[model samples]
Target: MVQVMRALRVSRFGGPEVIKMRQIECPVPQVGEVLVRVRAAALNPADWKLSAGLFQSPMITLPFTPGFDVAGVVEEIGPNVTGFQRGQAVIGWTRRGSFAEYTVVPAGVLAVAPANASFGEAATIPTGASTAWQGLFDNGNLQAGQRVLVQGAAGGVGQFAVRLAKWKDAYVIGTASTSNVELVRALGADEVIDYTATRIEDAVHDVDLVFDTVGDATLASSVQAVKRGGTLVTIAGMPSEEKVQEHGINVKSFGVVVTSDLLQNFSQMVDDGALRLLVGATFHLEDASRAYELCQGGHGRGRIVFTVSK
Candidate 1:
């Protein structure tokens, strides 16, 4: 008899109501992949957006699982894989199959979990922190002592951006609602702008980099804050090439790149107390619908997670 695992599946694109749980075969690891018995999984913007068909990329197939971040114990490894042992705790980005009891991912994306953090907290690292690392360092090319502004700094991705920038020794400024101003500041932001009370342009200007996590009007406003030769990078929306050329500023919008090295570095950072993991709320595997609902609201405090086995 084949073993079965529970997973959240989206058969059709719609609202939070569309997510449903189904019991399917427990996946066997293929060559160069590992089978992780998921202990916890965290939510990202893509969770609800994909569920709503808003970010329907070619990579997605119908009736697929929604989660991208997972923290769990390695249950088994496939042929041609080495260095990881069974029962070791790990966290990494999944290929869209993490909202389940068991999932398989390429070994290249797996990294040892931080010894100091819980499964729920570890689950938050893969997508959010990797994006932050790529956005600030790779794409934005933020340098130490340079001024960097993180737009919407209180959200999931924004929080990590602020912390990572601070880690790199950048002078960090962030924008958040009044409720999250102090929180952003406490996360090592040297300056926190209450976006509710002030326009970004009015409060700050001539920054070396603007890390915009909020798009649309906010992203448009952030360009004014960047120095003439500075860089503006956003994960939320694509800036027009014309706008970037007209201002003569480097602009980048990109998806997260998950690598074993990146995940290992993040784990070390967490263990060394250089980075903090914030879990705003958690739900049982059965209550995933409720979890998705809260995330869809776009105001949940930090990472929203699902406790799958623990």
Candidate 2:
């Protein structure tokens, strides 16, 4: 008999209230895919943005699951798949259907979960960490001994930027609210500026690289923080090319591209104790809507996860 599993899905674009938990037939793995018995899933701002009808594309049709990051045990492998076995712990981004009991993920997108982290913690890595990794190392060209400033350092991607910048041996300065100042500092920031108390323009200057997770005025201010000929990388939005050239600063905008190589590097960082997952809260699979609500509430200090089992 075909099996059915619980999934959180939405048939229309709207708020968290639109999501519904329902039983759906389990998906089968295809070539180069693996079916994961999802133990946990992480929430991202993209989840809500997509749900609210932003970035609509042909790939994302209506009545879909919103989660992207998942950590789980392998339940089955598709034809020609290698390097993974049933019952292995793994994590990756599935384009859709991750907020379910089982998700079919491309084998190349997954990596073994870190030995030190629980499924909930591991689930938080794929999206936030990979975004930070791409923004800092791949695009920003952050180098050791260079000064880097991270705006919004308390959020999911921001905190990972803090840790990864420090791991790269860059002198890191981060801006956060007063409540998260110490949290950002503990994540290896050499300096923490409370944006609530001080203006970023007044407090930080002469940075070699500026990573802006918060856009708008914050992104605009970042151009001024970097020294002449320095780089400003924004994950939220691209700054104007004309504006960048006027200041003689190099500017780039990035949308994260997750690959096996990136996931492997992140797993290695976790194994080496250089990276850590900060889970702000966890909800059961049935409460997936509430999890998304908490994430969208904009007050969460870190990643929110949904436990699929146990």
Candidate 3:
């Protein structure tokens, strides 16, 4: 008999109400893939966004699991795969099906789990940290000693951005609500603006770069916070060409691209005590719909994760 595992599946685009927990066949690893018995998984905005029918793509099909960040033990490895073995602890980013007892991960995105973190903590690193890394360094071209302002500093990606910017010796300023001001400061932000108390443009200006994790009108107004020759990078939404021309500064946007090398570097950082993953809340696999509700409501202080197994 084929092995089966419990999975959170979505057959339609809607809200948390559409999510259904069901048992599905355990996937076999294909070439260059590894079968992971998922111990934990982190939730991202992309998970809910994808579930709501946004970013519709040809690759997505109905009745598929929705999750990206994963931390687990390698249960099996496919042909031609090397450098990993059965029962090794690992973390990876998958396109889909991470909210399950078992998932098949593309080998290119897999990495050894950090020795210092629990599986739940490790699960929070992939999507948020990688997005922060790519946004600040790859797209924004942040430099040491420069002033960088991060909107939504207490969020999953925002907190990582603040810490990583500080790691690079940049002066980091962050915006958060009153409750998160001290939280942002504890993450190494040089300055923290309470967005609830003051407007961002008035509170921050002349920064070398503005990293906008909050998009919409917030992203549109971020141009005002950056210096004339500065850059603005957002993961939420891209500003239009008109805004770019009017602002006269470089503006870019990107989604996270998980790589083995990046994940390994993150693991080393965790082991060396240079980085941390903050999990705001956690739930069992059966409570995934409620987890989605919390995340979608946008009230969590950090990443929300699902603990599949101990």
Candidate 3 C-alpha lDDT tens digits along 118-225? 999999999889999999999999999999999899888998999899999999999888988999998889999988888887878889999999988788668888
Off by over 4 Å in 2: none
Candidate 2 — worst ten consecutive residues by lDDT sum? 291-300
- TM per prediction: 0.96, 0.96, 0.97
Model 1 spans > 4 angstroms off: 240-246
Give candidate 3 misplaced runs (Cα > 4 Å).
none
lDDT of 1 at 187: 86
- Per-residue C-alpha lDDT of model 2 across residues 161-279, encoded as one tens digit per residue: 99899888999999888988988888889999998889898988889999999888788789889999999999878777787888899988877888877888888888888788888
Q: Order of candidates by TM-score, top first?
A: 3, 2, 1
lDDT per residue as tens, model 1, 1-310? 1299899999999998899999988889999999998999998888899889997578878989878899999999999999899999999787748999998878999999999999999999998899888999999998999999999888888889999999999999999889888889888899999888998889888999999988988877788899999989988887667877777788888888899899999999999999999887889878877888889888767789898985
Q: How big is the positional error of residue 217 in model 2, measured in Å on the Cα after superposition? A: 1.8
In order, what lDDT does every prediction score?
A: 0.89, 0.88, 0.89
